[model samples]
Target chain A: MTAQIASSRVQRSSDMLAAPSLDSILALTAPGMECVNAVILTHMQSDIPLIPALAGHLISGGGKRMRPMLTVAGAELVGYAGEHQYKLAAAVEFIHTATLLHDDVVDGSDLRRGKAAANIIYGNPATVLVGDFLFSRAFQLMVGAQNLRVLDILATASAVIAEGEVDQLTAQRKVETTEAHYLDIIAAKTAALFAAACRVAAVVADRPAQEEQALDDYGRYLGVAFQLVDDAIDYDSEAAEMGKGKGDDFRDGKMTLPVILAYAAGDEEERQFWRDAIAGFLNSDEDLERAVTIIARHGTVAATRQRAEEYAQKAIAALSIFPPSPIRVAMEEAALFAVARRY
Target chain B: MTAQIASSRVQRSSDMLAAPSLDSILALTAPGMECVNAVILTHMQSDIPLIPALAGHLISGGGKRMRPMLTVAGAELVGYAGEHQYKLAAAVEFIHTATLLHDDVVDGSDLRRGKAAANIIYGNPATVLVGDFLFSRAFQLMVGAQNLRVLDILATASAVIAEGEVDQLTAQRKVETTEAHYLDIIAAKTAALFAAACRVAAVVADRPAQEEQALDDYGRYLGVAFQLVDDAIDYDSEAAEMGKGKGDDFRDGKMTLPVILAYAAGDEEERQFWRDAIAGFLNSDEDLERAVTIIARHGTVAATRQRAEEYAQKAIAALSIFPPSPIRVAMEEAALFAVARRY
Candidate 1:
């Protein structure tokens, strides 16, 4: 009786103290992720050496492959028995990869995943063309899945992603951008794919509409939570080393949540600093440091983290419809991990 | 009898003297084109203001809408009675427009179809993102067509097109690119979509594979012929003032047939000049004029035009399998026009 009580206490104490990790979901989908990775490798290739070379540079980089993982994990949750989910998972990844490639070009990013960005290595022309190749290949994989509804969902998501990118571009450096508009941009650019990625798993499994909707909600909220954290970390003075350059958004004048909230709460002098910085006049490292200091002063970075936690909760709640299985628990933990990760 | 003889003689003389025109094909597809244009206008729009503004800049620019016209005319040839062709046609134009937008970014071009390139006005970031938006919109439109096979064909063609583009980028400024490799490049980058555009008509019409193959052949040859003429016109000393910047390929060191043939036919000294010019060591208007002079001296521009005529002939003969109809006659004339036009 003493040993049983001590062991239970250890378990409860560990659960309480330990930060959430993706270990459960990763283990659950490891085998299927192997299959999806195989599909990605096989499909991202072309007879043109440059095509495969450029695509491989980014794909083989240490990406979490989070989008495809969601598909496979969602499949496991629904007990999908077919092989089509692998291909669909790969499709989800290609769309994400395509967007990343284009995103690097649009942002003129110098690095991705801590390596030089594809555009930096391959030049913008080849990078852009290869992105097109992968996107087209994504649709080809989707067509191979032979589910028209999945095609409709992913196609619409892709368009929305582009529109969101454009919207973000328009909002860049604009001090007047509202928080609501910021949320809409993230929902469209980032969450749409996440939702489609998870929803496609239920789709290929021929599951019920309720299960599909549940997965969609789960993925969408998780995406929003993840992006919020990403934006916050850019201004997080104590954040860990990340794959991207430090203060990238600040230098680029991206109007992320921390900046918006800080600007909203700033006094005359702080607001003047913000208006000048975001307008592209102040783009030095010192300026970035100043921006981060102001954001920390206003506690907006922590505020943004708190906001992300709310979305993470919504993501977890969306999974309640699923039964109390290990996969469901894994997914819920993954949502928590979305906002919990330092980088 | 006397009046009939005089009128017949006048008709014969005028037919012999008149240069080939797209008039017949244009008139044949006019009604269908209006519907296709309406579909294009309706679909190219987005809630994002920049998308419509940038897209309209190119779409409203005096584009001939030739690709969609081919679809509508092909439908007429096969007697396809469905309305799906219009949507498919619009989808084809979107793909083409998306490529054009990206191409301008890739080439860092200043003008397209006689006005400032989209990149020049909207900036590269917006240009790249809008291209992606249109490409996704193209896929959405294809999905709306609700034909799995059509989607497959276009998806495959789109991949091939990107592959071809990458291959061309690989081949740029390489003086060793052979005639055969050049042909392969054009076949992939330019002809694949043309072939798919025409083949889908036969597909939606539920025509036999033989007819599908015939349309594919027709379109593929015509595309080659058109590209040949376009390249030749860039070097054609007397060619009309064009919408594009003059000698763009030459300045970019693109290995078009004129360059390949000129390099092959020249002596060591002449080849050295060709090599230096193509390697970007020479890229002034004076250099362009000198290059044009050399091309004119070797008559390679005429040689390229002659080569185009041969493909145009093949394009015409491919349509011979169809029973004689006004649409068939118009398509045949369009092939002839593809070669006969100077600009």
Candidate 2:
């Protein structure tokens, strides 16, 4: 075992002592994730027919099942022996899928995951209704899990996620949004679920409070890092296409951290350009180009990446309480990948 | 007790032996409803300002709180002696209110409960997010109630409701929709919640499975009757304006029972007119007027009410297991009110 570990470390030294990939975590959790996927597929089905068709469109789309993966990985890290985490992990994924469906309608987006959004094909009415169906389906899955502590964690996370979405809506179209407010929004909308996903594993495993808190902190910081990098990549100017449509936040007049930082650091003339662009007056390709250029010149995208690294480090540190298993190594490297990935 | 019952019966005989009013049920469940209202107010709150504001706008509007009242009244009829029903009742109302907010967006309505809909005033995006918030809060409250059976019932009902909404969306503007299909839609979308709302009370009261099933039947039948009348009233020219904006079904190209019946019985020319109106080619006020005239010519509105009367009888009959009591009488009369009220 020591020889294998030494050889693996030697092999990864050229890649900063660990491979910047989710491969380790994905491999570690593959068996459990198969069960989670089965649970998700089973629960998303409905006699309505349209419900499954619409939900399957996005669920089968290339989401990577990141949230549910966190739940499974956390369960593995805690060395849980029960099968209850399968339904709970699927429930987490359902919550995430539901949010994506509603987010498409809320932003009136044309594309998601490099394809036409469910709202565009299914129409807004069906999209909204299907989102509701998936959300209700999520609760049903949680109830089937029969763990009230885990149910409460996910339920509270869901409410917080909705409030964050509403907060983002209220903050839309304003270049004056502060960094603190932006962080708050992302923390609620994204990190709350991630935290709950990890925390519930410890709850179901009957781990101590300190272990649950550590897992919660790990997932929360990783979620923030993931979202920050995502926002930065929207204007990265050199990255390939990720899952989401590029320039969506710009077109939607969303005040993400990169834009907020850029707006704060701009000259008067640059600020005027931002105010106009984010106000929806300047939304052409050329306008998007100029906005990207301004952000790049201000180096806020790089700054955003730098901030993401800090969160990723914190996420890694949150796992220090756990023993140094390969699962721990995979989880820490996954945080690095969250910061390092461009697409 | 017998003398008082005789006196009340003699007094009610002047108004047809059972009053066409909700006053009886309201009087019986007033104290319980007070607690439900308090729970609703407490739970709808959020740190985000817009959530409570948007939710409260429609919640405080005069909609009679019928779903929650069913919960409270069911508890009374079952002789429950606990406070948990209050939270469960409030949870039921939250589910209903969440759907209403989403319905406003789905239908693109200008008014709800005789006032400006939340979607109209707060914009569709905020309305959708707030609806999500309330839904999550509903489950949170249900978790606090600590009854997995009640949670399963409500969760199942919520998914059915969403499926019904999606099914309706699929059936919209298609005049070939069958009556059976329409009934299926209404039963799933509207009656499922009502059934779950009543049944949860029995579950929390720890009643026999038979009692739970009985309450479910009563609520399901009452909901169908209530919806049948609501649809009939939309096309009923003799009726005064209910809370909803009149002619909404006509304008939205919805195929309710009246329109379905009118089309089935109309002459060739009338059928063509029905198709044109339902397909959105002719949605003027004059078109709505002509549509109503044609429906009246076939007497479908009266026929629809006749159908509602049958369901109301079934609803009242579902209470046969209960012994003679004022609460039982009040519930039976409420079912009658579901049929008799013009609005």
Candidate 3:
């Protein structure tokens, strides 16, 4: 009976993925998102004008706000009716924005979300300082939530995310990086926050331990799927669709899942080609095209998509523990949408 | 009678400054220091070897650990005999170290504490991520301390410190920066944490509001005095004595109190010279020497020192509300020592 239910859900998810859109999922959390936005704008206020100015530049920029939406959606899934979820959702957004500001400086990129990166306009020092302010403000919001358990989860997630970023930094330009290593990196850098965002929803609702763990699993798998698709999009999508330039990961020599899979499956000559490419020997538009062709030849994009689909299935399975509801359906659809998006 | 006591304390502090050393203060906190060090080492552990390796490099890099010492000393002065102070002291050090890691990257600094900065060896992204890890670890420690008040104080201080750093960044190389602006920058960037570190001791000890406020004032004034002396030492001390380098503030075109005062006191031609020097027009050793000469000719170093002394006196006076004891005496001596140190 359990297997039958799981198989049916898997079939349904595949159908959902065929025409995936976040519209339904986003609509379910639209009210909570408005409250989250208000909280974000309110807490970002500072006596130092540069803080608000720099923060506003990015916050108002065209981010999908997917992480905060996940938080709100997760809260509703747990049947949480309290106001604390709004603050927690805003806190999640603040953490994401803070990391983005610092990430741009670390990457030394001049663009973010189709606009001039904050560091480019404000300078690295101001950008880094403002990032710190936002991070601290996120903590203040968590404290205001008046839940130590939530603080513990978010704080630990923050540390894990930082560790994952450092791990990725270590793995950069190294063609020897494995799929397992890539999974670990993504789990830490991306999935950890998603898991925490979902788990906090259960925390606020004072749900059973099983429910918390289930939502956490759902988010973790969904996040991994989302990042996998994002990495694949770097090689497969158009510049306009990606919201930043295409081939950014390739230009930066970042060793994402697609690159890792392609490198491992390639012949010796092809491996050397990847090595040189990542080592910056390859250049120009022709080289990028050739790199993409090589990736396609190995079927790594399809392999990467296959891996994302597996995680998406896991995300769907995790929700089976919860009873069926509109919120649950939207969340399950959101997981499918994560992997199905082209960009 | 109160006036007489204050005058006598002032006289004693002046005498103490003549032969100033932190030996007595450090000795008083020596046992607490050991526990704090242990906590720091334990919390810094990670499966990622790089996290500990980079953190250990800086943590063992021979900082005075003055901030942690202040925390331990504050707790001891409040007559708090508890284990929580050790964790709090370590948290204070972690916060300070985290800021330094990010600050080095922001400043593009090559050396810290007479060694190559972490960013030079580990890369900026690793340093930044590790700094984030340490900051989150600090919050985790605070949460373990189980005091909401302590969390509030430290979290708020973190935000203020970030704001101060941004204000300083905005003021950098601007000859028009005023003494008031300089004070505000230092107060937020440095003294806010100092005050929080001290105030948290009272919170943990469950001391009265008066004691909490008194210790906070003591830390705040001492921190201002310490930074003022540090800025003065940048122009007055030898490279060997200063650890990192002398004239770092000058080279960075930082608008310290001495620079602000000298610029304000200079004639039109001298003001243009100051402006040109700060704007990077002056680069040679002789130019630096001439800059020092002009500052001396205007007596700005002396003026800066006089201001530091005033704050140090205020720090000592703030301790009068606490009962006279060995701990109180050491704290008072520590404040005097802050301004008296040549480096």
Interface RMSD of each: 0.5, 0.6, 0.8
Q: How far is candidate 3 from the true structure (C-alpha RMSD, Å)?
A: 4.5
Docking class of 3: medium
**Local accuracy of candidate 3 as per-residue lDDT tens digits, A1-343:** 2556545554554567568678667777887899999999999999889999999999999798988888898888888878899999888888888888889888888778778889889888888889899999999998888888898899899989988888888888887888899899999999999999999999988999999999899989999999999899888733235666678788778888888888888889889988998887885788889888988887787788889999999998999988776667778888888887887
Screening candidate 2 with a backbone cut-off below 3 angstroms (N, C-alpha, C), the clashing residue pairs are none
Pick by TM-score: 2 or 3, better one: 2
Largest TM-score belongs to which candidate? Answer: 2
How far off is model 1, as Cα RMSD? 4.1
The reply for model 3, stretches above 4 Å from the true place, is A1-15, A237-240, B1-15, B237-240
Q: Write the per-residue lDDT of candidate 3 for residues B57-95, one digit (tens) a residue.
A: 899999999888888989988889788998998998999
- Record all residue pairs in model 1 with backbone atoms less than 3 Å apart, i.e. clashing: none
Q: Give the winner by DockQ.
A: 2
* Worst 10 contiguous positions by lDDT, candidate 1 chain B: B8-17
Model 1: per-residue Cα lDDT over B1-343, one tens digit each:
1556435433433463267778777877889999999998999889999999999999999888889999999999999989999999999999999999999999999999989999999999999999999999999998988888889999999999999899999999888899999999999999999999999999988999999999999999999999999999999999996788999998998999988899899889889988888889999999999989989989999999999999999998999899877677778778888888877
